[model samples]
Target: MNMAAVKLQTSVVSQAGKHTASVIFLHGSGDTGPGLRRWVYDVLGQNLAFENIRVIYPTAPARPYTPMRGAQSHVWFDRHKISQDCPEHLESIDSMCENLSAIVQEEIRAGIPKHRMLIGGFSMGGAMALHLVCRYHQDVAGIFALSSFLNKDSVVYQAVEDASQCPPLPELLQCHGTADELVFHRWGEETNSLLKKAGLNTSFHSIPDLNHQLCRQELELLRSWILKKLSL
Candidate 1:
């Protein structure tokens, strides 16, 4: 069933979670979440390997993304024309994060606590995951961001910094390829630092010779992490 609460259509993959955990994985620019789901299932040959968890893949809606010459495409948010310079578009992110938060709420309403779920993504989608989980005032199980980075100077980061008595941030497992020509490796490191600064428990892994993609090692690490999280 497609989740209509979000601006994009969502595809779900049901897994057995110990009392039912959940994961929401967003897709990158110009890609659908279902496509990512296929790669995850067919290419990776995995099922999330948990007892009873639902994996959610959400597709990005068509929008006037500014990065690719402002052409219409699927993207979490509009990448500034200057490309990672400054003046983060908080309004757009705010709307999207609201939708993302709603998705989590749907999961919670379905009988999962904030501690029994994790939100993750790759590339731009990863950026969205990190941004929403950290910036928006929401509680979730954890976060796993791959080849992703945070917009340090954005309102989202400001929100993280401004909240003096904020609720505890979720644990994070973030990884990036050293040779990532697309998102740049340093952003990943920067995001990790920011999360730590906010007192969030985050683990950062740098994949050597890795590019703007995932490796088998990365998948294995993710699998191990998920299993550990599920306590299986």
Candidate 2:
């Protein structure tokens, strides 16, 4: 793990009216920003082209993924396994998070306040989003994690514990499928529970019989949630 900054390729969905807010959504392992751009619109049933919301989709740099036996993948960070017990690759995680912070800094320079921006993603992307927002960008408007979970020993938990005084934490919205075999429903539940206990305003939604993917209902809820947060 080299700590050198990597510039990620990004696809932006510009705002219609004014650039009052921004949403940076990360893609899961092996997925690119352009790939997620299409899927997001297709799943949400509409482009995120909200009146004042600019959506940025960033592609991860290709790196050797451990679970795939060192095969390269466009993942925000690498890990030994998806289990909560697996140790996180902090070197790569920190390097990638710094790259992501560059994107956030650019938005801030353009006049978007941290409180008017939302960060989120699906699956592995959601995990990275949790790390980024929790460890670095706590002043963000809110965070959304879909079918996602953090490791039991994640730095996010430690960060919360190390805080001398509770800051105004971001509101969190997490949605998981009851039948998700990949990420497991219980993981999402436990993650949400832990965050809530850490004093975050968390809302969890469960969809019956769904699997490791998103559905119309989930996207509908996500769209509404983004709207409400950005409108504030």
Candidate 3:
């Protein structure tokens, strides 16, 4: 795959002063970087803003979605099905991970080290975050996945298990809702369990009566985590 093909367009939320750190957050399927940026401002407001940390929201390339029956959508990867039972489509996944790594590398060249950056997203984007951090950029500062999961027998577990010396996985904050019908809450819990078992610093939160969407409580936790992880 051409690296330039996956170099995505982004919407940035600039910080107040010189940026000391960066947050590269991906949007869910069908959502653009600008759309997610708008939602973050309108819904999250000040909860996710910082004085010296720039937030970059990258838009995925529009492609044919298998689950959506060939409908074109902005997705990090094509999936035949969106359930934990179905295996992940690694062909597109590996490509997207490389794409995300390019973004991280750009940040590195801009003076922000991998250890000073966080990677994360919601739903499908969250799944991409998992692959990007775990399989490609394990040295990142942290990861946050909202209402997301990994496929059965994920390479993440294998990467951890197969390492001769245990890799230094980043701190992870994962939140899921009990009422989520699309991606089941159990899948998120299982993801947390697997990550912890692989010795990652993982934290899982369950929102009662919540669905496949964000809530104030989740954003508050994310803000706290970000402050603790990447604050100057």
Candidate 4:
């Protein structure tokens, strides 16, 4: 694995009135940073009444996605199905955590407070969000994982166990489509159960009659959650 810095393209949407919070959006695999621009306008823009809120969309580095051949896309780390007991998987988890920590630190240096920052993404991006929030060193306002799965089962289990000896975890919102074929709905169930069992504050919603993509209602629900989280 390369420890080289991954270049991230960013787009910021500023609120004209009173600012409340800052949301950092990470896009899914194969999608550019600007791909989530419409989500800012449609979901956050229209829903958030506060003028001070800002939305930051960051693009992941384009890289080869292993296991799934003939594919290259934006990914936080190389995807591999290591043995269930392998410690190698934890190494990948740590790499992602460090990458996200750097990004969060950058956001804080740019004026976003740790308490007012929200991290979220869709698909692979969503998986990154979930992993970061669980293992992050600092506190964030909220976390949203949409159409995504937990990175790996064992790592999450260990994180949960460790969290028991520390302070509370941040609030988490997970949304998944029951009909999703790519990332099966079972992933959502497993993640939800794991997080809940860990005693973290979490909310899970399954969209009916939907597939791998997010539906209009799901987007609306996300918008609402953002507003409530930010108190906008």
| Candidate maximizing TM-score | 2
Worst ten in a row by lDDT for model 2: 157-166
Give each prediction's root-mean-square deviation over alpha carbons.
3.3, 1.5, 1.9, 3.2
Residue pairs with colliding backbones in model 2 are none
Candidate 3 lDDT over 71-167, as tens digits, reads: 9899999887877777777888888888778889889999999899999998888888988987778888989999888887788777755541676
Residue-level lDDT tens digits of model 1 in 122-191:
8888878877877763477678898887666755465555543665667789989999985679878887
For candidate 4, give the lDDT.
Answer: 0.70
Question: 15 in model 3: Cα distance from truth in Å?
Answer: 1.0
Taking all chains together, each candidate's TM-score versus the true structure is 0.88, 0.95, 0.94, 0.84
**How many pairs of residues collide in model 1?**
7
Report backbone clashes per prediction. 7, 0, 0, 3
lDDT agreement of model 2 with the native: 0.88
Task: Write one digit per residue (lDDT tens) for candidate 4, span 127-232.
Answer: 6777777666437887888877763454665676677577666787888888888456777777777877876688889988688775678777877787777773
lDDT per model, in order? Answer: 0.76, 0.88, 0.84, 0.70
Residue-by-residue lDDT tens digits, candidate 2, 1-232: 5644888889999999889999999988899998888887888777767888999999998988998999989988889886988888888888989999999999999999999999999988898998899889989999999989988878887775444157788888999999999557999999999888777778999999999887889988988999999994
Q: Rate residue 28 of model 2 by lDDT.
A: 85
Q: Is candidate 1 or candidate 4 better by TM-score?
A: 1
Candidate 2 Cα errors over 4 Å, as ranges:
1-3
Better of 2 and 3 by lDDT: 2
Name the TM-score of candidate 4.
0.84
